[model samples]
Target: MNAILIYLLKVIAIQAVFYLIYTLIFHKSGRHSINRFYLIFTLAIGFLIPFMSIPKFQSYEPYLEVDKPIWYELSDLAEFSNTEAELIPVERINQSDFTTELIVAGISLISLLFLMKLIYSHFELIRLKRQSKEISKNGHRIYCSQIESPFSYFKSIFIPKSLLDSTSFDTIMEHELVHVKKLHSIDRVLMEVILSIFWFNPLLYLFRNRLIETHEFQADAEVIALQQDPIAYQEILFQQINAQKVISSANYFKLNTIKTRIKMMNKNQKLSKWHYLFILPLMVFLIFSFSSREGEEFVAPLKNDVSDVFDYVVNLSDSYTPSIFPLKDAEGVKLTASFGKRIHPILQVERMHEGIDLKTYKGNPVLATADGIVVEAGIINEISWGKIIRISHNGIFETVYAHLSDIEVKSGDKVKRGDIIGKAGTTGESTGPHLHYEVKELNKGFLNPVDFINDFDFKRYTSIEKKDIIKLGKPNQKLKVVIDPGHGGRDQGIVSSNLSESEIALMVANQVFENFKSSDEVEITLTRDKDELLSLKDRVSKSEGADLFISLHMELHEDEEEEMMTAIYNYQSEHSAASQYFGELLSKEFEEINRKFKVGYTEGNYVLKNAMSPAVLYNIGYFSNSESERYLNSEKGMKEIAQELSDAIMASKY
Candidate 1:
């Protein structure tokens, strides 16, 4: 279910409960003021209750003293828990699918139409006021027009020209004056606007109808009280019952609810104030059912000496500051998008881009811009940022890294500047591989990340020259190798008219797996054997305890002549030397088979950087080249490529 849809449902449910209460208990009450207030108050509170949050108690085992229970108030606990005391503003996302988005668009369209209608209604009133002859009476401007009925909007009362000379003219003025003096037109307009937005909810229409009925009842009661003749006022209302009236943003002297108005007017007994006491429990029920509750960890109980705990409480230091660029490699930094308002590339709308995009290769390391505590490091509700990390620094500044393919740190973890937190990739609502970086201050909202970043110091954090090789097994143990076929299931990476990158990668990866499956010296594991959308994290996890991890992929190049077998290794990894060695051997094997081959290094590439062993991502061929595509599709080409790659992997071990 969509988050927006869920929120709408919650609001609708709350409104329904309020409606039920009104219809059952308060609708028939003679107290019109109380009924009117209940309807209007509930109408507003129904929409607000979902956003409301309350605090809840949670037991903390760390501070629990079983023998002597010590009660610590929330004020006292704030000094002990620094993060809990401070408020961090996190962006709330309403995750919606295509169908949900379409539904919301439709709803907005309908609401816009209703708003237009309301505007037109007011325009009609303004036009009528201009055309009519204004006659001043009782310090009020009365617009006498050639109409069948009378109505009031603001201080302007519109009456039929025939009634201005008739005996019932004064009586008609009295009813409409009540609407003007009491500002019933404002209520009418307010309800109309509410109805326009929530027209889909039938109960809202009912609420509007009920409000109109109460307005008529109140006006009738006032008129009867002034005239001191209930019978004559009833007769006047009955006369207007059959008259056709213009339904603009005006309270009319019409009788849509004539029977109810008469009954309410005749009733002398008022409902006891004690009957309203039921609302207290109802409000409590709504708060508990709909309002959000955040767990507050209880650090103390009821009894014991807790003065020592307060004395030792130390505040969190806010001295750490960022010094280096988030990306370690200065050469790889390519600014694709900058912060601030711009036409969104994907949505094609003028929206705020709160972060700066650093375009880098897939599987590049995303460093913490500053020494900070990891506030949030995981996948959120929306896939727009597939994996994100938010670090709070100096208790005032915060940095956010979004659209990552892999996350290395977890929430609450401490990190230093330039530390690898994740790998950048084309995850979420992205066009290609890049990192969306943001810088935020405590009071001031999102600031440009470029403002805080200094020149990248590549020498300070140079790539590891050598990596310790993990012991495979005993002297005669088989080498465990994990082969990952990139982009499966719904994720058809680098798609062409005839074939997808996933298909080509899988076909070649399967052939490599087949070659190693029968070998006594090697044991092979496929991250995904069939069509399935396996996450980058899942692919890296499967590489655990394996001697080597090889991710097979196919890519498209703009140039048709760019057809070559390429091997990419994570240069920053501790196993960089072994990965580079394997890539070199693989390049040589491809050369022996008379295939165009090249070996390169990348700071990005999720699987290569995060895999438990020496890893490499090998691009077999460019799908963009017609001849290369044909060769990749052919059975002979797959077998030959797989054989050479397997030969190199076996040779590289020596």
Candidate 2:
């Protein structure tokens, strides 16, 4: 609302400035017809612009589902909990305020008009009372009488009985009558009202006065057109000027009126045809500005409240429970038939077929193999799999189903054994529509899902035992370290000469893992055991309570002068001391491999900034140096750098 108000104010200011320019260039210089038109048009624009402006509303929430606490709960506690909090109810305030404001504004406008009318009436009454005191003593005056009406058009200016012989009095009477017929006094009052509304607008006031002067100019022109001796009329204007003092609202026959009126009467110049040219463009611009629709765009209503829909799903899941029962094994289930080698689709190699192939028609319902909660169910546009669903069976064991047609369940939904969760489809890496399933022990690792299903009973499906998946060494005990590879699935981070940073990092991480694995007293866990991308933040977050964090990378230098050197970047505020110690130790270990391996430290790097534990980022080699670049691209060269990285991390004390 504030933004919209500011925009309307700007447009009004621009129009006002243009109006001022018109007044200065044309109206103030000399009398012209176009100037009169400009004056009227400018006043109309000032009155109408505010009414044309509209308000804007552009705020909405996005749809997202995740395991997290509510946002309000996470904000500052004192502010959110206070009873007297000044929270703006946007929806309620917008409707009520706009309607009430419009009503009040309408009433204010009507009251203003009535007040202006009263003020004009009062001033006219005061002028009339003053005029009645003076009487025509000269016999040359035809007639003189002051009537009691503030409106000049209704008031009669009588030619006295004795002043009839004077030709100047007759001419003056005719001129005053013209002013009365035109209602010039009423026009002056209207202009004053306009000036009051646009008090700060100098152009409006200028145009008002100019418009009145033009009215007189037009009336004088009519008098001259009569051909009744212009010099005699000029003299008549002078005699009538002092006969009555100029009323506040009077527009003609006032003090100093003879000087300008006589001068204009003497030099009568008709307006040229070309004088209207300037108005053509001004009219066009006004038509475009006033007639065009330039307000906020309308938005269509949504089918459902998205936030409410999400809440509904969450409530449904909270109330849901999965039913468990025993499963019956098929008769004549040969061991070899159940699990054996099969021809691979892409590799064309005879490898172990780890899972059973569930043959079903297209769109046939596929059920959850066990009582579990849905951990992932969504459409995937990856190169290998299209749509997939993975469920964690009590957080100990899990099953995955790929190449699904449609997923009926979302993450966090609990399911019972044999529940229809999806339909079969040939979504990704398939010869036909079939369900590709896999099961894994929570910590122990992958177990052929088919093996467990054959003897499993839905009612008797007990929780599996948790296994120590990745063994870690005792605290203060010498432990072998493994730096798991990052970005292997389909993402190859930062590549040079077709050699990816992901592949290089993986090679180095694996080599380091192997070097440490040879030590009996040391245990190792690679961040990733296979080619896959692990989120850097997630990995660092879990590395809390870990002995060491070794993030490997191949450096890309834009400057040729920056050569092959191992730089370690760490957060200065959080882990500065630990990072420095780790860097010094790593540098010593790398020195044995090659003297060119130097340690560079940076406190501004993101990975180390929030790390609660000691962390080190190793830039194994530089792309700018041809020799180091070549070595980094090869398996053998990577192994050597990896060996140094492993020895450095293992040598560091927590």
Candidate 3:
């Protein structure tokens, strides 16, 4: 809604600037046709320029980075919690709130009223056409009616019955004939429609009046082109000085601006064609200033966050390095698959095999191939390699052990070579129980695990090292989540007497975090633990390896007499399915607690747009509403809200 308001303001500014330029320099420049087109064209550019996105040019260079090694239907991983139930009813709010929504609605209503008036006048013209007497004069159709003055609507020229027999009838017919031949009614209708939509813009009214004057100028010029005496035309206009006004939708002949119109007719200074060339620079300025600028495109280096371990793996394969076999005394323990391009057994598609699959029975001890510190040891709720462990060895290389049943070592644990880090089993995307082992140098991609394995005969293709192994059992896999409390420090959002939006947002986020910080199945990380303002880009960057991104925010509705409902917005894109599914689950939980909730999709939110995981921006309530502010600040109310949201998030793991 704020984005919509900003766009409208931008359009108004552009139109206002153009209208000012038109009035100061081009109003009486004596080029009616060209000036007419300028007005309409500027109006169109006002609406279009804001949507343009000009990409900046820069030299392109490829960065060394690991690519995704697996692909799956991300939406299919979560079970949607929606059920066949009665529709939920939303609570009502005061309609008199001076909120952004109310302002937009008011503008729409006024525009609609203006549009209806225009439509009714058009229909009246149709009725007048049907009721008036028609006659042919000098290859033109004329309609005689009880109107106050002569006017032209499209192809029909209507004149007052009293003027049909007047001495200046021939001259009046000539003027109306010019309007019909030049399609002046089309310009009037176009301006009228623009006025109907933007009735609040004073500049539009100015443009409309100027355009009508331009139509009269064109018609008067055309009349003069037929060798009509200027003094005689002036006499005709003076005779209609007291004529009653006609409907705005029609081009009526009147003497309201007779003196100005007459001066424009006699004006001698013609607008140079070069004068229009100045508009090119103005157009370029608008394009550069209003349009979105796209930065140079480049690949970002992979972070050390293990959240994306499913996509890229680090492998090591130095023949000079002596590494453990990682499998101890297992029957049929043999090399089943080698690294490189091969058909994935479970996916049935040919893709790069980043790791070598070892044939080993379930519950077989899996040891660390080298002395290293455990970096990642967890399970992801996905279809790719599951129950994985990544070990960073001496800051030079890393090793990955996937498809394990039990992880014995937690992250940050230092272990020697031949220590039992896990047990072999098929946990993710495997046809049978086997160990998928990988190794890689730091900053490099995955290498063939077979190259780093010692005590393995390449010709026999079978290996086992049943010695010097330490065993421990402590399995762990927590759903990592990043909770972003919007606004902080200097960026205090929506200040009130009780609390600001930033304070309240952080309060609610902390409540949610406190509920799950001790849970084994869930892990929560707050983007900001204190009242420190974090940039939207920084917030998204900090949530790099998160499984879910939840941004907490509050709205303001000044003059609101009732509480505003909560809203959950999911990211809108190809990756939106998972976010939408999660939003549905969260909205239901909010509803269960008697909180009226609305679930929608948004594309303009920066945090949501950049999130690499299932993300939602949760608008808690309006801060301007006194009751909502109190509820948000209350400890008990915050606790209940946190409990419901946390429950929904915990349920999404399956």
Candidate 4:
């Protein structure tokens, strides 16, 4: 059974126990003119409480431990030294496994919900018990001032000690006797429990008040049926009104509703039978609908034949010999210098080129090299490379495309192989229109992408660079780091056009956060999980104990004429050596991902200025140029940027 269904069953069980107790207490008193609609409403609300209560297990991630026992071994009695055979070491349960976590989550939430309700009830009972002690004794039972007058039941009613003699304590005692006979206390307690579950529903509060009022009305009518002086009862009620005490189980002495209850008590007319018919069907429909469970079970299926399918396809393709297709316009797209060797566009001087340049015209459609999600979309300014898109493929492989004239998607958009994501353009610091691309493998140093794509014809291209293979790294069990995604809620930092720097910072930070979360050596935390403003000092203060502090932001340019570039800024203090090292590593990685542009590191960002942990402020890319700005707005562009940044961060050494 699903957790929600189990929780619903538990709630039903608790409500059933309460109902049994109520029935047993009130069986002999005979059914009064109680509203059936109220009973149905309460039961319906009780059923919904479980689903409404948020599940606690939704946040757990799977973890694996490899150190202990593996498989179970059978021990033979003949081999054992002791006559009593001993069992061999068996496999231990993996507590961090995802399936195990789901079970734990369900049980934990049920226990927590039950415990919370119990605690709320216990405190309420204690408060009510203390107030009950204040009631004055009248004959064999105690009587108190009844503000929600006309209460039923034999339980002691409390009245102020001063007003005990002035009011007809005998008449009120007779009314209290009716309440005890009618089991009003049990009704009130049950209603209070229902109220607790639907505390957020305002209508439930109204129902509770109405139910209590009805109880008083019924008790008062019974007292009046005995032919006592109604005038004297009214007089008594008026005198004892000020002497009422607060009752936690039922707010019987609610000042606002007391007069109304009294007037209801005095009225002798009965509700029309036609009105009952009108409400009866509606009440029944509500009861069944509210109590009904609508949850569906979720089951994830496994693909056991995946390897077979891949092998079959590979075998079939290898059977036929393919013709060697010659490139028609290869000269137009050929790079003279190999990737990674710096060559100036005009000066012809060797410079460090991080990524391979694919010469293309303006408005040439750029396609995603693989299936991935776009993590970023915007113009890069002084802080980052211009018009960049980052996409995360499977595992640790990521691809970046930069210097685009137009971006066609936004953050969170999904793309497939060969899908046009943007158009090639010379935006940031570019001498001409062309596509700068980089493919990064996890844990592996950058490889020449040109060699990987050389086989493809120039006339037709698959936006994907299949040669940028990711090399999965060995699990590092000892490494530990925390990621703090800056600024949430109201404190949104600088915004340009529709892009908020704070939101972008958090987006990239979260991508890094998730990457670390998936790793064995990393632990992550956010400065603010939801959007809420934090002071610059607080943002820094929260990272005090972390090993690495990465503050994310999109840099803007004071001068509009500047081209796109990626830069890292670190504090200039003595302890910032580590920060500087991290910056250089990241700068090189960024450059490798997009070799056509310059990647540099500077010092002195306020968030990183203080002497503290190794911290780096990554200004992802610049946005001064128009093409870069448009790229920044596209989904593919953003993902490419985020993936590269995350890859760089993950690649950093302690």
Candidate 5:
């Protein structure tokens, strides 16, 4: 809402500048054609200026102020590697305050009322034309009515019935004819609409009034230019103003600022064509006003009492050379998947595997691959990284460990190579328990994790550069979501005699996919389609660029498992805020199904540990329980579940 106010202020300022230029220079320039065109141009520019800063058309010129990286999403003391300037703590006003909302509502209501009034004004004019007697005279459709003001609208001149036989009516008719021929009503209509839209800006009304004044001056000038008596024209204008009723919809002869019109009549100057060159500076000013990201305040980092851990992590990350296998038994663990180009497990298309997947059983100790500061530690996506942790060795490289059964360290915790950061497990999208590890060079996409560390040597690679971090570009669009349907292929998780976990999961996933596909609001993707083996590495990879991840699964009821629906989210001390919000919503939705939904976090999940989005594993029910199994198998139950889950996902949009 503050953004909206700031934008409106920008538009008002731009239009105000244009208004000043129009009134001070061109309004009285005696060139009606030039003034008319200028007025339209200014109005058009005012409307367009607001849309200029939109992404596709945004200017490439650098903003004087560089926004410091918003590290609030990271640890409490997290320090960015390539931040150009000191981060400023901005104390913005509460956007959700009642006063702010009231102001916004008031603006909307007033703008709407103004628009309705414009519509009514149009209807009123039409009714007047319908009631009047029409007669064509001197190439115009003249409407003879009991209305007081003699005015012109479009190609029609509306004359009062009392003035039909009056001699002075001929002069009024001639003046109205000039307005009709010039199509001055079109300008009035355009200005009126602009006024309605920007009703908050009083200057626009002034701008419109000045434009109308110029229109009358032009019409009067044309009439006098064709006649011999200038004094008679002045007298005729005064006589029209003497009447009471005014024509609000048309260019009426006796309407507004007549003294100024008379002054323009006598003071007509022949401005040179070079005067048009003055528009060059105005154009520049308009572009700068609308497009430039100027006046952004560069805030310095606030001074506060510093902690030793924060200082240690900042200093260590800046200097530490990182390279080590993140898992405890890196040399002994089976190489489940090597990092390189391969056929995508689900998509079938060949894609680069940036990280290596090592098959590790659930609860296996997972170590930090490097000595650095913990940047982000939490659940990223349920279908990608179940419990995840990212460590920044320097601004150049960030290492990610996903699908962990546990996270032992908090964000900002400085750790040396081989420190136990987590335990390996299949917490997210996985066929079984495993560890997915990635080492990424900032802005350079992904680098082979093994390239940075091996059994023989941990620090095999050289230090990364700050310049590489600067090249890290952002995604093109907002709100990309990845949905994963668990247990595909030969592995029919928690299957009974008739019901298959993989099939039920796929059914829900497909329904969710179809719903999302019908709406263009977000870009959506699925980790797997049909029954197939989807690697934990590939599932996490598919979730790249997504803002959220929804992993659908059916949990087999262990002796301790509860017979109810549940949602599992990331549990690190500094977990993803979006992931937390989504998990709560998912919990609420599942509770609506059975009124006994459980929302919680486990030690860690492997797949969601490294996903870039806030993720949740939506456990429909315990497959081991007979009642839950029947609910999963029932067609009506599946349909309702899908609808409820879709509603839960959409709630994040609002």
Candidate 6:
């Protein structure tokens, strides 16, 4: 669900850029069909591109962890322990409605209502068509009704009685005929669905307005091109300026103000094809703008800086970058303590302080440090903190806020940095009511929260160098492979006395990842390398660019001696022959590598079945069988399995 919202947002952003390009560059310069094609292409690409990942090849080099880095506390004399001290949940007297779940649920519910309205509109149009008297006029189907207004729905045209006898009927018919033959209703339905799905994006609404205008311009220009009396058509359209509005698909002649239609009709100039080429640069800009964060070698700008900040703070009303104080509408917040060694206030023992504590009101609202996805949220009895929220800015950077009076986000919730994540209070190993803030860069050093805030840089970065861009700008010559490791986090698959599905799958996937990472022949990716539970939506969204996909898993059964492995594929896949061929190759590899194991073919696993690429689900030996379980967990078993799979992939002719 979180992935769906993120994808929608990415698409909305891309669509906004494309819409701007069309309005400022191509809309006025080219002929109707040319501009129409551009608009459609922009819409189509915007909707699809978020699913397509830009290639990123980071050198998977090793790094050593510093025992004591810049941000390391002086109080770490005590060793870390898995068992945390019993902690109390923080108490907040009054809480506000600033919560992530409510906001997401509200948006989703509203979109559903919008969908219902769209369905109603289509059905209402159909009901009207069924009740109306039908007659054939000039090789078109016309439905005569008592409606005060006239409009076309799909291939059927509905006309009111007042217009049937009027002299303007032929001109209106000419307009409606163009709409029907050109299949404008299909465009209307598509636009309606797009709007329904992305109703939150104001840019889409603006784009819709432009699209409606373009449709009218095309139809009006066609009617006038016949050398019919243009004056008569203008008079007919404006005469119904106060036309009764009705629930229908768009592009009505009388519904909107007649000024735009009349103005377009009055124009008399031919545009040059040269203007359309301007789109090339804008497309490049859009790609670079988004690719910065996802590509390797690109240092992320401070999230919500400059234009991103403009979008949230100035325009959309949110905050990020942890630039501001956590307390909202507060003045002169003083730092009570620094992040370092401190005497445990209550315990009377020395300890390293990993986080900075700030002096504030007991129930003051606590904001997020940056724009990120909530990785962890809730009260933890196993930790010193009562309620903690951890958010990951990218995959590499994370911020943790501990000892909160209340938590407003859950795992997988995307949040802006300044949004009130909770109320600050004393909870779990706290001396007093305050907020504990920490910043950690995975595999790097943790930085002082204060220093990180003050020294935050907003430089934009990208990995697509000139030559790389030129290569990517052309058609692909490299193979793209995505590997999905089945089950993770709380959704850990098939657990038994000794073997864990998620663990074994990840171990094998990691080896496969290492095998492919060393080679430049294929661009390899994993749906997950760690135990972060991803929804089916999230998995499918990231699997868009794969030429071949493999999902790893281990399933247990009732029989203890059942040790044979099975490779599953999408029986309904478009490339079924290719999948079958690869499945056979995998069976052959397993048989040749280890005679102790046998391979079989199966069909219809969800992850495999839904993959767009030729994908398979490779289930390792069942943990249900004790002998197989011991063998699967052995280091030798893991290496042999990984080698065989890698070899099979390399040996594939496809």
Cα-based TM-score, every candidate? 0.48, 0.39, 0.43, 0.30, 0.42, 0.43
Better of 4 and 6 by TM-score: 6
What's the true lDDT of residue 157 in model 2?
49
lDDT leaderboard ranking:
1, 3, 5, 6, 2, 4
The candidate that achieves the highest lDDT relative to the unseen native structure: 1
Q: Write the per-residue lDDT of candidate 1 for residues 422-528, one digit (tens) a residue.
A: 99887765546778888877447788776666443212111122113423333577878889998899998877667787887888888888898788988878898
Model 2 misses residue 609 by how many Å? Answer: 22
User: How would you encode candidate 4's per-residue C-alpha lDDT over 445-490 as one tens digit per residue?
Assistant: 4555543342352232111121122211224543334445545567
> Model 6 over residues 519-619: C-alpha lDDT tens digits?
76656788998988999778866668667788787755444666767554553467544564566567778878664332222234456657777777676
RMSD of each: 20.4, 22.7, 26.9, 28.2, 26.8, 28.6
> What value does the lDDT take at residue 386 in candidate 4?
60
For residue 619, model 3's alpha carbon misses the true position, in angstroms, by 37
Global CA lDDT computed for model 2: 0.52
lDDT of 6 at 180: 81
Best by TM-score: 1
Better of 1 and 2 by lDDT: 1
- After superposition, the stretches of candidate 3 with alpha carbons farther than 4 Å from their true spots are 59-101, 297-654
What is the lDDT of every predicted structure here?
0.71, 0.52, 0.69, 0.50, 0.66, 0.65
* Structure candidate 3, residue pairs in collision: 314-440, 315-439, 315-440, 316-439, 316-440, 488-533
Residue 218, candidate 5: Cα error in Å is: 1.3
lDDT of 3 by residue, 193-296 (tens): 88898787777787778788888888888887786588888888999988976688788887478999889878878888678787889889887877533333
User: How many clashing pairs does model 4 include?
Assistant: 56
So what's the TM-score on candidate 6? Answer: 0.43
